[model samples]
Target: MKMNPLKVIKNGVITENPILVQCIGLCPALATSTSAVNGMGMGIAAAAVLVGSNVVISAIRKFVPDEIRIPIFIVLIAGFVTVTQFLISGFFPELDKSLGIFIPLIVVNCVILARAEAFAFKNGALDSLFDGIGTGLGFTIALTALGAARELLGNGTIFDIKLTPAGFQPGLLAILPPGGFIALGIFMGAFRKYQERKAARQGKPEPVHAAGCAGCAMSGQCGAAAKGGGN
Candidate 1:
């Protein structure tokens, strides 16, 4: 199928952002986003795996047995994640230490596996590649913003660069686990409101593609629920 490249890109980044819209990969988003640098590192590392797995899976979709498709996808994602882990450890030791288990944990990251199964398994190679990139970028952008917000409020700095005045007291909660959830909740709410306003302006409901949710890790559950609803 000939998919519009621009639309594919826009869909991942805006229409259905992996983090903001689908709410996948919150583990890393919450855990690693204590600072902008940490968040960016995690994002790029995952993006590398996401793009590679998507391309390889799409290329071999026809040959992979339906029964073993999930296993094969996991292996492919693991390979990419391993490679990414090595590159980060070798060149960016500080970030490697900061991310720690999360780096290796990317192998099971829902965002990567979900895209491989739902998108690459069904789409052409080129489109799948773009989808991976777009999704990766969206994921990266979301983490960066989240991290920046937390860092600024928690540490009175962003990317380790001081911005707040000397007397400014940093919010301890901003850097804690509770803060991540709070920040994410606020972001999700704002995103939904923006979509709603945009739809209203256009005089139509915002378009939601099931394919977007299909790429979510909870797709199986979602599908089952949808079927039950239809019955």
Candidate 2:
């Protein structure tokens, strides 16, 4: 089947947003979103890793043993992450510092592994590239939005420029670790509500399962409730 680049991009940016919708790669999403610059840097680094890993995985899928596919994907992903980490450290020192350990931690990010296993392995190289781009863009958008919100509230700035009037005290909590969790939870709730409302407005059949909740690591908890009519 022919792949649609536009559709792939759109899926990553909104429909299957890795952070806001899929809730994958939450560690970097939370850790690096303290500032817009940091978030964007992390996003770009992750995008590079995702794209590189996807392309490599797609090209090698036929050669890899099924039993060892997971390990192979991890090695490929880790290699790309390592490359990105060094590039950032060598060139964008400030960003490297801002992103910190999160950059190296991308080696194990579920987003990369998920795409390699699910889409890249089965798709053509070009299609896998688009998928990676889409997923990366989605992740970037989510992180940027969250970062903007956090920075604006926590520091009274956007991208380090003052936004609020003079004498306004920033809300320190917004940039704190706990705030990341709170912000993400609120965004997820809002997204679910939006989906529900959109389905109702379109007269679409109510979804049998929650979006992105299926196949999740914690699905046993959510899925059990969903099956029991507790959702």
Candidate 3:
């Protein structure tokens, strides 16, 4: 089956952004997003894992057993995550130190694992690659934006550049973990509202990919509710 590459990429980056839409993988997003650079670093590492794991999983999907698929996916994702951490620690020691434990935590990030089970396991390698790229990019964009917003407010600068006056007093809370949550909530709400308005303008209901959701993490609950609605 031929897949529209643009559509697949757009789906991951926008229509179904893991952070803004699905709201998966928030731990690192909040922890490492105290600055734009940290957010970008974390995002890049996760993206690498996503692409590597998705391609391998899609390529081997046919040979894997249904019962043990999750374990197999984890093993593949772990391998990629290990490689990513090594590359970071060796090449960008500062970033590796900043990310620290969260770097390894990518192994269990719902975004990567969920994509493996939901899309990669069922799609062609090329399509899966694109999906991974899109998803990773989306995650990166969200985190970077959140980090930048927080850093700007807290430090009165963007990515370490002093954007405020010499005597400016930053909103100290914006640089803290609690500020991360506050920024995240605002971002999520704004994105959803924008999507809703766009849908309304197009004369379409809020978009919901029911078919895709059927294979997603929330599938069991969503599927049950769907069935109940039918009956």
Candidate 4:
């Protein structure tokens, strides 16, 4: 396929990170990323499934009926995820136990399905393979970073090795569920800032996000509801 592999990978990791930029698959990302190993393990496992499913879906796209394509895509994804789970369990018992049910849950992750629908089906198998590789790396980078941060802050360690001074008190909350949101928020803010700086350095205009509910980060804090009620 006529594709720039590095560019595609860069887009996935920096521009369209599944967790950091797209904000998809947060539940699994947050739940299993309490430590670096868990995060890395989950990321790699999900990436493998994503890559396999994307390539297979792209290869078989021609025959899939329009109405049932979603089901077919999901089935393909589930098959890949099942294999990935088994491989993980056999090779990385600690990771399998640490990640728990989240590994199987990869079947439903929006990132994988979104890629299947948006990129794989429309692209050639070779392109889809690279796309999968790129996006998977993005998923891995985001999770690993988040997990590392949480691990370091919460336990004063990374990959189970001490990195902090003896006097440092581990920030217990950093490993909790709330820590995920807080750490993610900080990462998002930093990512945006990095994008802004990169744009400035490149002498390009700052990217502006679409305004209003379609792109709003508030989820559903809509003033429109109250305005409609009043009217």
Candidate 5:
């Protein structure tokens, strides 16, 4: 199918971000984002795999049987993930170790699989490549920003470079699991608010969130509340 490369790129990076906006790949986004270096490394590795898998999938989309498409996509994604893992291990051992299983785990990451099913399987190879790059970059940006924030707050440093003044007592929670959740929540909220403000400034209606708490444990309550408000 024909697609605008620029629009695909923009959609993945900003309009439909996999991490900050769509909220996919939260597993790695939260687990490996304790530092900027770790986060950036993970993000870049994932991006490489994404671009590779997207291109391959898009190229062979027509021939693949619809019934077995999921299996084929998994294999393709797995291959790319394996290659990315080895590359990182050979070139950036520290990051490789820090990311650990998460690298290999990219094979099963919804971000890759979702893109394969939603975009690559339907779009041209070139468009799929751009989509992969855009989404991957967006993922990278989110991870790096979250990592930087956590590292700075938790250790008074970013990428292990000390930034705070001497004697600064960093918050231990910022680098811990709790810190990850809090930081993620804060960032997501901030991004949504920013989007809202931007839309307002441009005289556009507020963007309707795609997920809209559908995956939350409290989805039932959320639905009820929405209906109540509507009434």
Candidate 6:
């Protein structure tokens, strides 16, 4: 099948979103989203790993045996994560420290693996690259949104700069792990409601179930039996 770059990108950004939709990579999503800077740093790091791993996986998909495909993908992902970790440490030590173990943890991120297995394995190099970029950006966007919300409420600041009135008292809970779960849940719920309302407004047909009683022998007289009985 020919790969469509636009479709691939769109999938990562919306349809197959790794964060708000798919709910993958929650570890870093929660841990690094305390501030915009930290969230952006982690997102970029993960994006680099995703893009590199997707390209490598796509290039080797034809030759890889299905039995060992996952192991191979893991190795490639680990290599990219290692390179990213070193580069961040050498050039952006503060960010590296802020990110901590999450950098290496990128190797195990399900979003990267899901893309590699579901998209990259079947796609050409260019298409896989596009998918990686889209998915990475989607992740970054979600993390940034979460971070902004958390930081604003938790510290009364956006990027560590106070924005609230002098008398404002920060909500300490917003920066905690519980706050991450709460924010994510609220976002997901709201998104789902929006989709439902949109579908209703568009007059979309309800989806049919293939496993309904109409197709089952227990529905009453079976199709064959009904015809034969009448005959």
Best-fitting candidate, measured by TM-score? 1
> Worst ten-residue run, lDDT, model 5?
210-219
Q: Which stretches of candidate 6 lie over 4 Å from their true place?
A: 205-231
Which order, best to worst by lDDT? 3, 1, 5, 4, 2, 6
Error of 6 at 126 (Å): 0.6
Better of 2 and 3 by lDDT: 3
- What C-alpha lDDT, on a 0 to 100 scale, does residue 181 get in candidate 4? 88
Error of 2 at 62 (Å): 1.0
Error of 5 at 166 (Å): 0.5
lDDT of 2 by residue, 1-231 (tens): 896899987877877777766767888999999988888888889999999999999998899998888888888888888899889999999998878788889997878887887788899899999999999988887888889999998999998899899999998999999988898888778887887788899999754433554433345566678778743
Considering only N, C-alpha and C atoms within 3 Å, which residue pairs clash in candidate 6? none
Tell me how many clashing residue pairs each candidate has.
0, 1, 0, 0, 0, 0
TM-scores for all candidates? 0.91, 0.90, 0.91, 0.89, 0.89, 0.85
Q: Positional deviation of 12 in candidate 6, in angstroms?
A: 0.8
TM-score for candidate 5, residues paired by index: 0.89
How many backbone clashes are present in model 1? 0
How much is the lDDT of residue 120 in candidate 5? Answer: 87
Q: Of models 2 and 5, which has the larger lDDT?
A: 5
Candidate 2 to native Cα RMSD, angstroms: 3.7
* Alpha-carbon shift of residue 34 in model 6 (angstroms): 0.7
Which candidate would rank higher by TM-score, 4 or 5?
5
Query: Which residue pairs in model 1 clash with each other?
Result: none
**Per-residue lDDT of model 5, residues 1-231, tens digit only:** 677788888888899888888888899999999999999988988999999999999999889999899889998888888888778889889888889899889987888887888888888899999999999999999999999999999999998899999989999999999999999999999999999999999999998775653433234567788778763
lDDT of each: 0.89, 0.84, 0.89, 0.85, 0.88, 0.83
Candidate 3's displacement at residue 130, Å, is 0.4
lDDT of candidate 4 over 13-79, digit per residue (tens): 7787778777777888989889998898889998998899989999999999978998998889999
